[model samples]
Target: MRAKHNVLLVTNDHVSTLTGMADNTITVSALDRTKVKINGQEGVGRDLSLHAVATGKEYVHETSKDDLWFFFDVEVASNPALAGVAGFTTFVMILFIISYWNSAGSSTALVLVALQILCFFCINPYLIALSDWRNFMTEEAEALMHSSVGMNKALKSVLTLIVLLTISIFAFLMLKSVLPDRSIQDMGDWELWVAMLFDSASLTLPFICFGLYTSLPLQVVQILASFPFLFMIFFSTTFSPGAGLEGVKGLRFLFARFYLWCVIPGVMEGMEDCPKDNLTLYTVLSGCLGLFLFLGLQGVLYVVEMNKANAAAADFKALQGSDEFKQLQVEMKYVHTDGTPRGFGQTGVDYKDGYEATATEDSTITVSGGAEPPANEL
Candidate 1:
């Protein structure tokens, strides 16, 4: 067989061309031919010919090593999607750095910033990966991938939460150490930081759970995921002077920031003189409230999906019993075994008199002499 050359070069430069050709050159030589006689004419060629060819095994060797190396080292390194996420994370970190410098050594603002970072890290991935989860469900059966769809979703969510939380904590500590006028030592006791981290995660849990379990579209889900942050910024007393106002205090539970604010003492203005007993009570209540919201939202989503499924099934059953479906079945019965209408050549039945059924673009079956099927069926 004639040999073919397939060269892989890193660039079109002369250096790359020489390097590629030197290692991947192939040589072929024609063999001597003998005279052969055809049916009507004689030809000066051998019945069978052979040629010597070089293996050029180095061509495959060079390609195997260099192609993959270039793909992963160069192509993947330059991918915009990966760069976008990293750039966004860096931008957010820059904002936090600015906040660190401007907060006037107030740990409350820093902790709030940390919680915002935690929430962003946790929910951003959910928004980005929702389409992937949907695609996976569409392409594979639930039984093959996990015990159930909910279990698979929960597993993914839990793993992502752990990873993002670890990363956020590490980033926080690193920033605290390297930034001017800030050090981990001045961030207060380790136990307080630990408790703050726990409460922050608790505050973030319900939003994460909502993103995971809700059946809403991606845009709507994202808007809902952002509601807590917006509410905290504009409606809560986190950065405002209403912390001790009677009306604001009464409605504090409605805002997630209030729970977090209560967890850290002296964070709220006018509340520094408040009793520690009340702050401790709010701390305990925050944990309980987080758990309650998390589970309650998941349960509500499950019920909503179940109700949707039941309504769809009921509609399908109603469609099955409808007169249009009966007419379709009757018309189908007159078809011959070979799929031709029995009325076409039958002696007694006239095909013209028979009902003609055509399915519309919306998939509703219609008969020539009857009203169009209802759009609400299924």
Candidate 2:
């Protein structure tokens, strides 16, 4: 009897399987000769002939499978959703500023522009991380299973910072073009802008970490992601200076938007009627502490998720080795090479005229041979 067995070639090293048919002559064929070995000898062409000893054992060798996660691109530049959202928000803010240009004071308008930009950067990472968590975690988890290096969080963060910096420069140019000369002068130097951009990008990391830490449903994720933006709009120092949570020094230290409001106005001392009394070294250190606290909490959450994913992967591997699964796989013969059920001509039915015959469940079907029947045959 001719029997076929499937083995997982996880590594390049030789692996031996016992056939339990003593002293039998065996012939092995590979899709490629140079890439495979049989019984300690490389194939002569596509086939390798071997004599099994009384032990009924044979060895096969193949190259290692490439780690799928290594090729996954997690850098923010590859994600159009993030860039598109940022661009749209920037455009809308610019329009708002232009519409109110005649009524609002230039300093307040400039501050408003800065706050809007800061809010975009602050809220963006959470949404993106939540939406793309599966992609991120899948690659990382698989890479861990394969004992290979996965996506590096530090590397991704650095790339994200670079993209944010680029966007910040473009935003600055647009804001400069719109603002009056006096307001531009009061906006401080390039150093201040760079510092603010760095802080904004750093602020995004905690949000990203928090998003990845949660495994909620999509609706819940969206709701949770929107909370930060809503909080900024309603409570933070984004709008009226005298109203809504600005008096709460603890909030100013905890949230990035409030922290920016407290710090940036102080740094730009030239701007009249701008709040500057809150920007102290101690306040800056407090903001940093808040960021670190979030980072630590999210780090713990990530480790928990990683452990869960690893355990799930182990269970799946065990299930793959079960005899029931193997039996089911064998009974389902009319499947494509990739193991999907053939969609067309898969019911072993015959029709008249243009209709084609289909294979039975006991038979196999190739993709090219499984053409759809005529439309009239339905």
How many steric clashes between backbone atoms does each model show? 0, 0
Point out where model 2 deviates above 4 Å: 1-107, 110-126, 129-150, 191-203, 213-227, 233-238, 242-250, 262-290, 298-378
My TM-score estimates for the predictions, one after another, are: 0.46, 0.46
lDDT of 1 at 210: 54
Model 2 agreement with the true structure over 1-378: per-residue lDDT tens digits: 112122433332222212211112234545544333333344422311211111122332221344323423333536665667667766765774576454333355455555556556544643465436545554654544432222344334445555556666765665555555555455454533543554454445444544454455566655654555565566544455545443552353344444444434333343223444544343345335535766687789789999999997787567556654443333333233455643333332221123333332212222346486544433
Shift of residue 142 alpha carbon in model 2, Å: 1.1
> Which digits, one per residue and each the tens of the lDDT, describe model 1 over residues 1-378?
012333333444445333322312222224423643222223423321111111123222222444444434532466454455556666766665665554444455565556466546644654565545544553453323213454445555665566455545755554554343443344343533453555455545545555566555666656765655565565556666365567645555555445545444446444333334554455446544655766886788789999999997787567655554443333334333444434323211233234332332222342345466566631
In model 2, which range of ten residues has the least summed lDDT?
A: 47-56
Q: Residue 69 error for model 2, in Å?
A: 12
Tell me each candidate's RMSD, in Å, in order.
Answer: 24.7, 16.4
